[model samples]
Target: SVSVLSYAVIFAASTKLDITRKDSIKFICTFAILELVIELLYISYYERKKMISLLKGEK
Candidate 1:
């Protein structure tokens, strides 16, 4: 889950120059969603690695 304040900051920064509500909302939503997906993928990879290590008795 992306932090709310971070999302707001992102939304604010993107629209600070243009002052357009639509553009800012679009940019923020896209970025936040992408970041959330990437974080989930990273977590999945780490969990899988841990499981593999445990199976091999290396941890």
Candidate 2:
């Protein structure tokens, strides 16, 4: 998430610096895809851990 946000900020700044439209679009799409993947992985890991704890009567 942090990485995604950082990339977005950098991309925005780069646009102001006169970066090409195509490059900006590419960067934004790449970061968005990466962010989605990271979030999915995180959610899956968290849910699995929570389920394990519940089954063990730890929560």
Q: In order, what lDDT does every prediction score?
A: 0.85, 0.86
Candidate 2 lDDT, tens digit per residue, 1-59? 88767887978786897779898888788878987999999999999999999999998
lDDT of each residue in 1-59, candidate 1, tens digit only: 44888887787678668668887888878987898899999999999999999999998
Which residue pairs in candidate 2 collide? none
Segments in model 2 whose C-alpha atoms lie over 4 Å from true places: 1-8, 16-18
Best by lDDT: 2
TM-score of candidate 2 against the unseen true structure: 0.72
